[model samples]
Target: MRRTELFFPRYAWRQPGATRGDERFRRASSLLCSLLLLLLSACSSISPKETAVSKTGESTFKSEPPKKVQAFATPERLKALDTQEAFEYRLGPGDMIGILVWRRPELSQEGILVSPDGFLTVPRIGNIQVLGLSVAEVKALVTSKLEFFYIEPEVTIRVQEFHNNKAFVLGRVSKPGVINFPGKGTLLEALALAGGIPDQNKDTSLTKCAIIRGNDTIIWIDLEDLLRNGNMALNAPVRNNDVIYIPESSDEMVYVLGEVQTPGAIQIRSGMTVLKAVMLAGGLNKNANAEKVFVVRQQTLKGDVIRVDLKKLLESGDFTQNFSLMANDIVYVSPGGMTKFNYAIEKIMPSLQMLNLGFSDLESLGVMERLRSKIWGQSGFINSSSSGATSTTTTTSP
Candidate 1:
């Protein structure tokens, strides 16, 4: 019976079958791998790469993406910018006037720092009220008065102080202060006198500078265009009391710290948002908790600290939450586990060291010793490298 069963078992059971199941498994694995590779390739291909100060968050701040200025400028405005006026010297208070009468040397004299009462002291004419009169008018007045003494007094008035005509250049200039005039100076000339700008400086544009007059702030002047492009019109005539502010390039940067693939300061170019800034930081790490992206922004006047959720902004282009960043903004991404504390230590240690150095220096010299410092104490010398007392003492002792 066992021999009969053994012979019968070799029938259909021993027959070779098709490997369809094996083939199906292999095909599914291939498709999944292909899909994964395609996804990776797609990701690899995605190479991610302001004009005036506007009052409101409107189109006024919109820059026409940077193209050559030749193509970007409006023809109408270009024409309007080209007009220049003849230099007309006007007389005002504080102007040092040099009056020269051709024949009458005794009558000719120099007047400086016109009195608060707006009068200039003259020999025979006594105190002449020449404050509001033009140079030509002053000349005529002086000539008419001198005619009593002699025939046809040739009077010529040259200004020295140029008091009324001046510009105030503040903020980020090599020298941020007032630049006075009657050298018939332009905005360019004024800026040059202020040490031209620092190399590590920022400006509205290479050539663009600001001109603030009273309540009005007119911006977007191309200094380079005025110089190189032979666009004399763009070199707008500067007026008295004009405030020119050459603003630093948008300090708007996304500061990356802790566990970032490329952690550093990423500049926030135009149309850039939090998400764009993040991507520029070489995306998040494997352990990065994307949901915990916090933007620490200081509020206006109130000095309130606001935290923004960049994860939500990235998922959805919610620019409202992607608030335009300002200068000195710190963008922080909390790291996984130990990196968070590590980041804090790395950042704070330097600041603490600096503070320590400052305190140590202060402590090294006793309070009594510091107070005993003579010239610095008296002169209110806070920023001098050497104390005035040291020099004076050295001079006296020697």
Candidate 2:
């Protein structure tokens, strides 16, 4: 009987359990248990699927697809220049005035400067602060003052040089600087005086031009719309000390990395769309899945995310899908590999390797050609053989 029979007498014993047999059985049983323990230690641990998942599973970063760009259809607020509200011109310190005493030659004055305190001392009119008052108000005040002494007087007040209140024009305009408000001035007149904007001015784009007043007060004006539609309402007038700074259209760049024929930032002009940007990036590589083109646009208010399918737009010419690209947009074309690991490898590494290999092959071929030419002189093998054979024949005949 086996030695294990002695360890558990009833189970192993069809016969009697002797002392030696029992010892052998106990020894065999202990050895078997030790072997099993060692085997268990050497063997790979078998875990429940759930337990394995709990220990080492990771979540992947799947970016949200880009939403179709919606067309902004908000109606423009209409403005009428002719019947619009008359602007109120305010008086300030350091403004020059011309007070004409109509028909009264003795009292007529050509030039008069307002005092630092905003007061103007007129003849026969006790010192009065005309600051912050309109030209009409000043005329009325002077006329009232003259009533005390002279017969019915007619007075006319005119500003010699519009000062104190100023506006600035900068950027792509022919001339950019502080512009004085001659009267209630319109933006059109101001731009014209500044020599008109350059044809290449970025302000001509959809981003439009803006007017800034108090902090956080920005009024965006669509120059193209106003010019095309003749909307006088959008032609808001500039105020005193107002700055009109024009910015160059920023040369935006879109990165077209991963599985693209050319992976780099492309020059993005005004109104450039994703399809156009992709074309600039040299289009998709052979391995690229055209159906999986994505754009990563950074939003001012939201977190960064992957964007829409560009193929549909490109193929169908969907106006809505042709969204205007912002600065620094990243366009990624996916390589349709089955596994994530394969996808990354095909999209990111193999294509670069292929390009390198192609270059290396070209270089090697050039080197081989050079070496072969150096070893074999300018005359090829056939030419050399013929010449040698002729020389031998000539020598033998001679």
Candidate 3:
């Protein structure tokens, strides 16, 4: 019998009819492979993102993923973005316009407010529509009209006050409300005016800022790239009524219901997994069918229900069944495998009815307070710090 060995790194193949040495090599290789597999299992079990968000069941809400403006964009796209950055301020209703005729101060007027009808009541030009017109365009119009009264009338027009041309900035910022752009508001400018995004301590890669134009277009920009990396290419021009939403961790939420100790809404943070969410909901109850856990994600009218075996994930460290949760996702653990979705909803309805009848738990109470705060501003607990102590004062919200 001849002794032969084939080897490359951890891999090995045994030739048939070989000697004892070859047999020993085969045994060693098999052990190495087993160890390698165990190592992989250990690494996967310890992975930080072991819990992770995923796909659909239910009515179809057609969701187009947010369009990301890449930080390292092409020169052509950057050029296009640059063109919108230096736009002149447009005049609109309630905007105060100042007009000067160089030497003829008598003909000029200061603090002339544009009427709600978008017309500026100039002394001689009567009411000229300057709502959507830029300052230069309005000045040109005024200058041309004054030409009738003087030779090459030198007219200088400026916006004394900005009452219009507003952008709605909502979400996690120092000031989250309607931000007024003095003139030529860009995406960056709008954010700055709203006191910029607050310091986000979570994973920056997961943080995104969106610009909603009118009712159709949504422009998504990675806040990490724009703010941390100083990516100016993502800064697009903001139009009037454009809504910029930079959601905070508290702003986004997920629902954990059915068979949980304290089933309720949980704020979604970066890397929030199903396992993590379950633990936050005070772990599962004794009656929970951990093998039949369902994640219901609904967008618009369309959605999907994904089933995972939580027992496998938590007990055996089977990472395949555990997935991350997105905003507004519902994690439902059934009491039995044959549980119906409608029946679960019916069970939840009784609790809601009880709340309506002036009966509520701590979970429901906090949720109700948050809902009231959202519907009507300043309707929740207000924290005011005094010397040597912090106090929470509650305010009634209608």
Candidate 4:
């Protein structure tokens, strides 16, 4: 057929290369992955430990460790906090006094009110300034003035009513307000007048109470010593306009976690021991390794980790292993094998987060109901019989 070697060409179908949309999608996915990684790194940078108390009683998490625990005021130091000079009640304006002269009835005066200018008009002596002077000083001044009239005049002055004096008791007390003292009052007396730190079992911070005087001077009052140890040395005499502040509990907490039946923070009280705290946490769980209980105490910036053999303390009667716990301490009961500190912390993080959420708030958010439903499932409490039928019918009908 001489068809010019029949020029025929064979064609092959080939797969298409990557399109523009595919490249764009790949870039977007890479960017999304980078953003997710960045978010994870940011979250991981936050500190896991919380030490400061929030208004909701939740601890504020901080990256930096707390400063070392400062030594408490010693007995000698606290005793020396009182002023060396004895406190003497001084007369001021608006004060009513009784001036009596024994055997000299004519010169005795009753209900002699001190003038607004702090002066008292005597029978013979003219107006004399008694303001800013103690009772004894006023008596001596009046006696000196009466010396001109009698051979040796004897004068006695007594405050009939204290009108110009007031003390304030504020912060975390049942009754917080201005308190008027009949005469000289002590720190303890003022505290009693203010209802002695509201809810002594829960809200009061006995170790952090303070007595503020004037504008700048502040005296720390260790109620723990005064109430628990019976050391009244720090109960200094309260002066006029003095303010006693009983702050709410702050660091008075002990955290129990890891293998405890109830893992959470427990309020600390006087003479709180590891055994007591464990019991307060509903005792150890079945998986708890009673032999290796750890107590991490924050004595300073760096915490002190104490290893306790609860097995020895409970079974062998070695009480030395049952140590007294301090405020802001962390107790962790291991799970049989050797427990790493970081692993224990990881295990406790969930409990701390739960505590931070606050049970009341969680209940209000219906989380408790959801949790209960999950626990009971469909067969237990959350009935899935008629409800299940209704759901199936609705889905099938739709």
Query: Which candidate leads in TM-score?
Result: 2
Candidate 3 residue lDDT tens string, 26-135: 45445545655754554453446543334444435456653232243433554564446456667778888888888887888999999888998888778888888988
Candidate 2 lDDT for residue 302? 55
Backbone clashes, candidate 4: 6
**Candidate 2: 10-residue stretch with minimal lDDT:** 389-398
State the lDDT of candidate 2 residue by residue for 1-398, as single tens digits: 65543334343223454455344444454454565575456446678665233344564634565444323212343242124377777677778888788788776776688887899878767678998898889999899998887889988898886676667777768888877766776678778878887775443343456566556645566665666668676777677666666556545466777777788877666567777777777877767777777777765435465555766766786657666677677878888665467655766575466545543443333432222333333311211253445211111111
**Candidate 4 lDDT over residue span 235-282, tens digit each:** 677788788887666557889998888999988765688998999899
Residue 174 error, candidate 1, Å: 1.2
Superposition TM-score, candidate 3 onto the true structure: 0.49
Instruction: Give lDDT for model 1.
Output: 0.60
Q: What is the C-alpha RMSD of each candidate to the true structure, in Å?
A: 32.0, 19.9, 30.5, 17.3
| Better candidate number, 2 or 4, judged by lDDT | 4
lDDT of each: 0.60, 0.64, 0.71, 0.71
Look at candidate 2 and give me any clashing residue pairs: 3-25, 66-307, 66-308, 79-233, 166-241, 168-244
What TM value does model 2 have? 0.57
Better of 1 and 2 by TM-score: 2
